[model samples]
Every structure is written in structure tokens, then in C-alpha cells.
Target: MKGRQIILDQINGREAAALMVDGQLDDLLVEGDAPRPGTIYRAVADRPVKGQGGMFLKTPDGNVFLRQVKGLAPGDVMLVQVTGYAEPGKAIPVTQKVLFKSRYVIVTPDAPGINVSRSIHEEDERDRILEVAHEVSREEGVGLILRSACEGADRDEIAEDIANMLDLAEQVLADAEGAAEKLLDGDGPHLAAWRDWSEPAEVVTEAGSFDTHGVLDALEDAQGSRVSLESGVSLFVEPTRALVAVDVNTGGDTSPAAGTKANFAAARALPRALRVRGLGGQVVLDLAPMPKKDRRGFESALRSAFKRDPIDTTLVGWTPLGHFELQRKKARQELREVLK
Candidate 1:
């Protein structure tokens, strides 16, 4: 209960995985209706949008939108991968760049290189991982990226992972000469948990693990709009059609520095809150009434917090109305939508 735990369970017959850290829900993954990111499709190109610089492609599931379409012509066949979840009634977002990602390595086609994770700072460790990568026989022009999980891992296990990924990539790429069809389905929640959550933790696979470990209760709290911070401070995170709106409040605290305190607390708690709730896209924060001089401090705190967050987020700076704006990638399905 005091350490990290990975709880795998089923909710409404859909696979779900929860990351509990020190008795609190840190992250969550729930299977949704859309195709998961990294699913590769051999698609037939459809009509290109006249002004958008993107084209629609016909996949087995449905039509998907691929951006940066420069040379793609109608009826041309190409391989594409799902990039992320699409909005309601929108085409699934996809990219021509497909990657075979595993726990220890990511096989990149069309990009040739062998690179170790920068986090493995020791020269010896880097060289060792590089040596292992070189030993694997892969197709020319295919790249290998050693993930951070390779650090301190068993050499044999790392090599096996790299080899397996490389094999899978080769297989998938070879099958790309066909008509519109799915080449590979993305990893499900259970496999994704094992693949992405590489940190040391106790694994729970029991049927009632979510309820037994209090993950259900934590998820209920995350679904709400209010997140309690330190002391009596709190923040309301409400997602609307256009953007997510966050309102930080000082609550009963009437001290002179209450606004600044609440702002900083909200800054620290915001990333985790959004992550667990699976909220993304444009995020606008309406912080407590702090002075202009404190804006820099709030921005610093927010930037630092998001730096630790795994999702890609751009701090777009403050609005003219004293609100902070952020553009976060829609990496996962929204919790409210997923549960419904």
C-alpha cells in the first residue's frame, strides 16, 4: 500500500490497468472503442483535403486522416500508423511514420541508426547496450533505439527484446505491399501496462484487484472536477468542448500569500490530475489572484511539473486575461468518455 502497484482488471468487460503509487492513483489505461495508437494499417489513399494539407485514407476499420501529405496521390497505397485518439466524429489521426515499440527497444523503419537512451549516462553501459544492438541482425535502413528501461536490465533480456521487436518490424513492413488492411493491432491494456510501466512494482492480476486495492475509489475521485491540494486549497478541472478549464481556489485560507500558495500547489498537482483523468488538448488555467510578479514563479513551477509528465505538452504562456494556456497532446481517451 505504501509503494507502487500495477493493478490489472476488467471494467465493463474492457481491459483496464491502473498505476497506484503510495495508495494514490498515478496513471490509468482503459481500452476504448477507437484503434489504439501504434496500430499499423496498410491503407488506400482517399481524396485529399483541398486546403488542409492532409489526406484521408481507407483502412479496414474506417477512414483515417494522415497529415503532411505531400506526394501521396489518390488510390495510392501506403503504410500508416495510428498516432492518437481522434475527437468525436473526426477521422482517426495517423502518421506515415510507423514504429515498433517494445519495453526495451523501439524499432524505427526508414530511419537508420543505433542509439542508446541518454539516461544511461555511463559510457560503459552505453557501449554495452550499443554492442547488444549491433549484434541483432536487422534490415538495412531500419533504426534501433534503446529505451531507458535497458539501463540496469539483464543483457540477455535486453537483446531478446531488441531482437523480437526487430523481427516484428520486419514482418510488418514486409506485409505492406497489399491493399487496405490492418497489418498490426496495437497492444492491449494488459500488454501496454507491461510494456510501458517498466518501473519496479507489485503486479496484481486478481479479478477484484481494482476494488481490493482501492483503485475504484481513487478513480471515482479522479472523475470529479475538484482535486484537493495541500491544506484547504483545491482546484477544479472541468473539460469542455473547446478546452479544459482549471480554477484554483484558496478556500478558507485568508493569508496574504494564499493566492500564491494555492497557485503553486495547483501547478504541482495539475499534471497528475489531467493524466489520471485522461484529459488533454488545449488546457487553460485560471489561477488564484496572484500579482504579476508571481507569474514567472507559477510558470516555472508549471514547466517543471510538465517536464516530468510523460505526455507531450507545450506551455503557450499566459493569456491577456491572466489565464495560463497549455497545448497538451491528446494521448489517451478521456476518462468520462471511456467509462461511459
Candidate 2:
């Protein structure tokens, strides 16, 4: 369990796009931008089309949503920060931005009647905290995330973050106005994800070229764990939705009483293996299902086969098909430590 770095961005919605790690959102990036974010709502006097509000339309990129309607008005600013990555090459998928949805108090007087009516989703509230972050990102009329960094944080800390965000947003506005184009907010989702993962694990790279020191520091600060790196651990990946198969190499733990011994061992190690491998949900262990009769029968033989790691085996009783039923935790991604 090592902390890694990830990136983050505000994409189609207010949510930051990212992949779910341990049921947590990591890696985010903003995908598209309106042609204009703070232009005044000047109604066309002579011949205006119906429903046209002179609003700046952030051009839609691909179907991947990294955009959101923050209801910004002229002079109103939106703040963004560029975060880093969960692991090298583990870029946040722009299409999955919806995974990080949140609701905030939005003030859009120009919209006439649009108010913050929807209640916040539990998942968002549970994951992120609203701190003085609101102030740092204030532009009069905009919505933004009170990132997980603010969760349980002191009021002073929140306020400081908010101020920082506001300052950053103002700078972005200045650049956009002068450029008259879609201004890129140097900070995006990628960096955010990187910072989040830097917690709980150390980020190691094969080559020393991709050094993101600032991202690692920010992640270490946001989270209270040290990130480190390891070497010589080879990772193999196999993409399969089929049932996961774990084979234990006991190198001949088998003896005259090996059947019962192996079964007991597998029952003990099985759980740990499942957790380490990040396997879960409905798992078909394919172990020997029947009773062993003094640990030397067919049951004993089956147990010996998987006993090396047996803690994970929860004999969910037996199944109608005479097959043994067991459940393992589901992992969001390929388990990097299954073999180890």
C-alpha cells in the first residue's frame, strides 16, 4: 500500500473526472471551456433569437464531460488548480468526470430564477469538505468544489485555500480577457489526481525524467502520509472479466496429512490474498466443496490445493450445484500486488 500521485480537473459538470481507487476518486482534469466565461449578458436589441441570453457557450469537446454550468456572469470568476497524477501514465479519464459530482450554493442573479435547489448527494458530501475554499474561489456568481483536501480542516485553513483559489481565478480571468480565446487553466484534473494518490503510497518511476516534486509535496501536505518508491517489483496485468484464479505455489507442502493441512492453510491465506489482490463481489473459488472425513478425503485434498492461503475462504456453506460458494472483495482495477 503505497501513496501515489494523480491529476484532477473540472470537466463537463462540476464533478472532477477520475478513476475510482479503493472507492475514492483520483485523477481529474477540466476538458472543455466556454468561448467566454464572464461576458455580460447584453440582449440583442434589434433582432434577438428566442432563448438567447448572450451567454458564453463553452464549446463541447468529445462526449467526455469535463464541463459544467457554473453560471458565471461578467466579472465573475471561476478558480481552478492543476493537480498531479495517481501513478505515472494513470491519466484521469475525461469521460468519467461524472464520478465526482457535487453540489454547492451557487449565486447567479443573471439567470433570473435559477437557484441552488437540489440537495447535495451523499457521496459528494462524504468525500469532499466545504471550507474557506469557497472564499478563495469566489467570483460573485460561480459554483466549485470544496475538494477533499478541506474535509475536517480548520476554518482558518479553509479560508486560506479559498483566498488562494480566488487569486488564481482572477489571474485566469485576466488571461482569458486579453487572449480572446479559450484560456487554458494551467492547472487541470491530472494534477489533482496525482496529489491525492501521493498519499498512502510512494510514487516510484522507472526513469527519473518524470519528476513531479511539487505535486508530491502538495499531496503529502493534503494527506498525512509519506509517499515512497520501491524497486524490482514486477507487475503483470491480465484484463479479464471472468472469475479470478489464484494459484498457490507451496513447493510441496503436501505430506501424508497434507489434505487437511493444505485446506486449513488456504482458508487462512485466502482472505489476505483476496484483499491484496483487490478481488471481490461474487467469487467462485472452485475449491473442493465436500467434507474431508478426518482431513484425508476429497475435502482434504481440495483444501490442500488452496490451503497455502486459506484465511480468505469463507465456506459460505455449499451451493445447489454441489459447488462451493465464496465471496471476495471487488477491486476497481487490476490488483498490482496479487502475485506478491
Best by lDDT: 1
TM-score, every prediction: 0.97, 0.28
Each prediction's whole-model lDDT (CA): 0.92, 0.33
Please report the candidate that would top TM-score against the real structure. 1
- Over 212-289, each residue of candidate 1 has an lDDT whose tens digit, in order, gives 999989989998999998889999999998899999999999988999999999999999999999988899999899
Off by over 4 Å in 2: 1-195, 198-206, 209-243, 247-251, 255-283, 288-340
Quote model 2's TM-score.
0.28
- Candidate 1 deviant stretches above 4 angstroms: none
Clashes of 1: 0
Worst 10 residues of 1 by lDDT: 131-140
Candidate 2's residue-wise lDDT over 1-340, tens digit each? 1234333322224323233233222322233332111222111112212353322222221111122333434433232211211121322112101111221222222232222223334555433444234334445544454444444446665565445544544454444332123234232334433433323333333222122223323322223211111221111212235555433222343445543444444544444334333344455533422244543454444455445431234435445654445543222222332111
Model 1: per-residue Cα lDDT at residue 206? 96
Number of clashing pairs per prediction, in order: 0, 84
Residue 49, model 1, lDDT? 92
lDDT value, candidate 2, whole model: 0.33
